[model samples]
Target: MAPLASDPLGLAIDTTFDDTSVAILRGKREVLANLTLSQFKDHEEFGGVVPERASRKHLEAIQPLLAQALTRAGVGFGELDYVAVSTVPGLLGSILVGLTVAKSLAYLLARPLIGINHIEAHPYANVLAHGELPFPALHLVAAGGHTLLIHQTGHFQWSIVGRSVDDAAGECVDKVAKMFGHAMPGGPAVDRLALTHAPAAHRFPRPMLNDPGLDFSFSGLKTAVLYYRRDHGGDLEEGPVLSAFFDAVIEVLIVKTLRAARRFRPKAVTVSGGLAASQKLRAAFEAAAAEAGLRLLYPPPELCTDNAAMVACLAAHRYAAGRFDDLTLDGRPNLLD
Candidate 1:
């Protein structure tokens, strides 16, 4: 099927976790308002997102964000070509806000409602921005709730080729950052500090890297960093020993992603989700892609984390392909395919 051209507009509503972002896309480009949570930035002080707190924040933000998106798009609710929302693999409470809101809008407007998977939304975000996604692609979704390796054979067609056994890459980063007294969304904090530490200063196990399967396990690496910090007090030459701990995590992440790229031999490989925002992960993936002669794609830094643009983008694709979900669709907190 042909992709959407520049003429038709696709409206997307994303309620993933605490942040609710809304946008209108003219083809692959965002042509409307985009809003994010200031609350999440505040919540980071506590080290992680609290479900109830996030749910409350979403309830407050969703209405305003949607109103602004409609205004910015210069269209009324009935004018939307398609209504899309992330329906699976996110906080159930948070997902409910978007689903109900989208359902109400779609029902009232008589437009099709598209349900999108939060993880699938991440990789499709790049496709929307780039105009095309090379087939048989590998997407490493390294985020808070999930660390999955996805195989995308076509639009809206994907399967989890592999995944983490324990502790997502983002979770590991957050917990490790907490060990060093860094801010929340520990991936970036760890990445920033890791720049000053030696990548080879200490060797942490790669955790299933040597295994023949494509699965990943970061729990061991998380514990390794914890023990390293506990034993050495996070001390390095000019900073806390936690600096070295960050370096180890980056190395393992890079190595594992690269190994996946080589083994899968996909047309393109995408590193997405919150950890995709990490400078360390981006640089490492770019280098690995170049060395292995594989295509690598990522969203803009802001789009890397949870946002409606990715959700909207995925929704657009599914909508265009005649994929729709009814009110029977419920939010899956731990929803898997």
Candidate 2:
């Protein structure tokens, strides 16, 4: 079929954190453009992401990125059928930046506006990668900000079975990487180092694994690493220490998620979020799924991080379900609330 001006389009904006990302999609999974501008360098010197700086960068980068997405997708505003934004589970100011722009566009273009939960939209990344999510599925979301295990019975019908009681898995990874003197967003660095090295002789404790529940706690694992480095810095290399730390986190995640899958009897299991980018974790999951005789899925590394394509894909479902939001929709900074 020939492309037509009348073809409907969807636009997604994501400013949930330090990155400003815009995505354009035709229908659901057909992503045309996903332009993201990373602002990690601006906050890297601060040792962590500064919320105010993240918000300012979003305001500056969003318009240009939106323009680039539209141009790259070869679609104008007139073709837009809906506008979507990651509106919650983020810094208030940063989420507001994207939501305001989305609302204004919705009003001007008379298109439907969909406010997506950043944490919830993560599973949609898998949906974008693999069409039609299997019902009665288990979803482990290990993004930097949130870690939740969702039991999904259908679209928009899911309940959290487990969540981080303290530090998120991705946050633990970043802090562990910073111990090796890497920058703030150091999960990638840790992943690279972990790949090159074997697990350390020092075995870190897997937190909450024996608690008879699905909840997780990585703060203890992180503190164990701190104590190990302080007490025996000369005893181990960074590569091995990092490997052991990551393995601790992965064990807790995998064990708890698999436990939930067995209890819930889900048809398949899915992993999403920033930590899902880890090849080691993916390999471990692949082996576990193979052994357990269960189906497993995850988005590619690019989709694992903060991006609007997931938001857009989730919004496409909402649009089809008539789940449009009015201009009065406001930002909710608290992800759980």
Candidate 3:
């Protein structure tokens, strides 16, 4: 890797509505400044995420957040060797805010434009903090919009081994949380309650565990939980039942991820994306990896969620490999490839 001395400086712009994070990477080191839209904490009164609300929030945060990242990196526009942006596989409006800004910057500065895939960037977020990803790596990305198991064959190369048949884990949690009047992004709130509540107190079915492949199905589980709530309607309130529901959700996530790891037989397993912040999932994956005798790697909780650091790290890898996308690159609405 000696000729790689001229490590391309990497810049990433993440306009994901949940958070607007920007990062600059030199070699593999991350220099970052991120901003979040706090409106959700206020809007949680509705008990779920509103897409339109998220879109507008991202638009307001994009420009100022980008400037902060540049300033913190202390790199002038002229010095940037690469400009990276996430163009697809995300909300259309939110995706446009970032692509437009990054595209314009790439054109103005005459730097190589690297359009990154949003889901692909999740695992590399771990690479940003941890040097390189282990080959045959299994990553469980649990975010609001996606729940997928990816096999990491090498840098920037992934084959989706399994995916959700219906709702993603995070989405299920959000919807279920709303059932109990929990706030937006119900994962955190549920996790907090789960800490004091025992998971074995109630029995919730683990979907797709009996089936083949690493694929997962949570829609049934969500509905099952709903039916449980309905059948037990007005059963004199709540102590153990609520605990059981939280436990059931955590179990489903842990079990499915473990199933993926067992099937992939990876050198290491990474749990990434927004829901990776969950303490229950973290503990569950760690314990499972230990029992399975596989290494488990995860980004710091804050980085585990959506961020630009992962994008920058991926860009750095692609840049070193002489891989660069042309300006003609378009944002893919379903840019999994």
Candidate 4:
């Protein structure tokens, strides 16, 4: 659908790390085109994102990705009412790449600039996927950099209930996969391996499972894998090893989330971020939801990862609420502040 004065159009940019992505979204929930150019190959050898390299790649790819997204969406710069960009809680250089582009577009086009929290926008992925969420929902965000449990009372109201004290679940997964000689962005690779074989005979530790508070820790678990691989050969079977690792992460996540659900009695339980794409995790959550008779909501795999569609989608709400940032907008390296 074409954007009009009533239903304003938005351009969303996300260069949080290894992906240079752009999307054209109409109004609140309608995504016209979302495109991403992954920098996986560039950072593959590093076994993790290198900030300088990620920034350089975003610069090289953002302009072309924007052009392609506009073309695919059948829209032009003149049609955009606002520019939305993820501005915080990521690599400083990488976030600046997108924020700069967004600032320039906002200044030239005389449109509102909306700076979005990458973590917060993740929960809205569920909103985009499942229409609107019922109020007071509990959301689990398991991404490359952050793992959090948020209690949402409304569109703009959120409180983090649980968070990773050490390594993020996805970060642990990537590091563990890197240990196995997998690529930089190894969540998908490890997930695929986990689906094939039974868990290793060595059962991994589920960190922070019995804690009274809803905090999480996966560093020990990841370290356990390191020690296991050290004692065993480097050529150990990967599928089973990854299976055990994935299970530990998933179990800690599921149990803690349900604990929060019980305490908060939220209307529903939702999943977000890249690691939310795991099939086994989804299956386990689905079973838990069924057994508890609680509603389970999550975005499709496409929206689960870091994408601009979710950025623009959340921006649409901020646009309506007149929550706009100025040209002085700067990237925040950590969301905690």
Candidate 5:
């Protein structure tokens, strides 16, 4: 639907890593247009994103994507009420490209600028797609670079209760897939292979499952896969190996997340981020949340990955709160405590 003439429009830009994207939101609830330029093919030969290459690609794609998003939304630059951009916890060079472009647009248009936390924005993507989420929600942000279990008590208020101590879940998937000679951005490939293959008789260890706290560790599991390949003469069937690996990873994520859900008794359980698009992972979460009698929410598969829509969705709230940032804002590559 077209945005009403009176509806306020917000623009969002994100290039924290490989995905260069732009989006427009009408008020807080309606998405006018969301465009993303993926760099997966560029990084396929490298088996993962190359920071320098990613930044360069973002620089080239950001302006074009932004124009396309605005055109598709049927909104002009002067019509935008706010500009939001993801500015942290990502590749430094990549983050700077989007942040710089966003700052320039906000300045030229004299619009309010809002800086978004990439991780925080992921959960809000659900809010944008659906309506307001049930408060006190347990959110799992599982992506290539991060795996966090966050508890949201109110708008813009979050507490991270669990995090990956080593390789994030998505990273583990990629590494394992690379070991098996799978393509880059290997999570989806591994997931698909796992679905077709039966689990091997051997099982990988579930790290930190018995621990009494809410933290995650996948390095050991990744290593186990590596050693398994070596011991099996590096000729193990990909299907069974991937199936066992996928089961191990999914089990840990489900168990730890459910433990947190039960302990906190959140009204809803939300999962977002690129890996959240995994059909297998979503199924496991769906089953567990159902058993726990908690509502489960996730964005559409498109929103599950890195995109500007989540940034804009989050900006809508911050804008209403009168939160704005000045031109001095800079990219932060580390997570905020």
Candidate 6:
């Protein structure tokens, strides 16, 4: 089905971490402009995002990005029907920057304000890109701060069935890359090296694969990598080590996600979050979904990472549902489902 030609416009702000982004969406189907300013260089020397530094950068970049989004969308402040911001499950300082800006916009423009859960907003990114999803879907969100398996029964109804007990998939990847002396935001670096390099004779352990429940545990897997590096004189080839590491992680993710799919028998299996951009993981999931005779869905690479477009898309749905937050809305760093 074709998406609507025009719908109410919404403005979204996202500063959950180092990425400062703003997006303008028309209803849930059309994205007019989505802009993100990465803080990789700012945090590269520190090896990861520092909360204070991330917040400072967000303050510097939010206004410009917001203007760009609105200008590119050809929409005025008064034209916006709602202002949305990601308000939970992120660095407190970073979340505050975006939320503050969004609140000011909402107040000045007299537009409805919506506070969105950063994690919940991720799966909806697929909906924005691909029209609509079949109901009763299973979604896997793998990112730096979260690893969750969710069951979506309707527009706003969600149930978390599984999640990580320790480090998230992206966090594990970054930690492994850092151990190998890779630069900050190591997930991409590790992914690139892993794809190009062949696996070594050694095989990394797949954590929690044989566990009875769907919960994940990657800390042990990460520790195993550290031990391997120490035992092997700490000079193994980057390609092979990373290749093996990614293999273990992807295998565990696929096995657990497929297990949940089998239990629930969902119409579709979806993967989102920063790590969901992994080519190897995506290939594995594609095969798993096919084997299970279920449809597979995911956002594009750009959408897989943190972006305000997804926030705006979810806000549109919330707006229609009459879900609005007052000026007292506050950032929630440890918010969970």
Identify the leading candidate in terms of TM-score. Answer: 2
Q: In model 1, which regions exceed 4 Å deviation?
A: 1-6, 39-55, 234-243
Cα lDDT, model 2, residue 206: 95
lDDT string for model 4 (120-223, tens) is: 99988887888888988999999877899999998879999999999999999999999999997798898888888899988989998988889999999999
A best-first ranking of the candidates according to their TM-score comes to 2, 5, 6, 4, 3, 1
- How do the predictions measure up, each by TM-score? 0.87, 0.92, 0.88, 0.90, 0.91, 0.91
lDDT of 3 by residue, 184-277 (tens): 7788877777666665455887787777677777888778778888887887244355557656666766677777777777898888988888
Q: Assess each prediction's global lDDT (C-alpha) against the native.
A: 0.72, 0.86, 0.75, 0.87, 0.86, 0.85
Off by over 4 Å in 4: 1-4, 39-55, 234-236
Decide which is better by lDDT, 1 or 3. Answer: 3
How many residue pairs of model 5 clash at the backbone? 0
In model 3, where is the ten-residue run with the lowest total lDDT?
43-52
| lDDT (Cα, tens digit) per residue for candidate 2, span 114-220 | 99988888999998899988889999999977889999998888899999999999998899888878998889888888899998888899999899999999888
lDDT for each residue of candidate 6 in 1-337, tens digit (9 for 90 to 100): 1222246689989888778889999877799988887623453433342334343488877766676677789988888888999998788998998999999999998878999988889998899878788989999999667899999898889988999999988899989899989876688887787788887779899988999789998999999999999998746787898898998999999899989988988898889999988887787789878887889999998999988899999999988777889999999889574
Candidate 3 wrongly placed segments (more than 4 Å)? 1-5, 16-18, 37-54, 235-239, 335-337
| lDDT of model number 1 | 0.72
lDDT of 1 at 237: 39
Q: For candidate 5, lDDT tens digit of each residue in 248-332? A: 9999998999999989999988999988888888888898888888899988989999888888988898887777899999999
Off by over 4 Å in 5: 1-6, 39-55
Q: In candidate 3, which residue pairs get closer than 3 Å at backbone N, Cα or C atoms, i.e. clash?
A: none
lDDT value, candidate 6, whole model: 0.85
Error of 3 at 174 (Å): 1.0
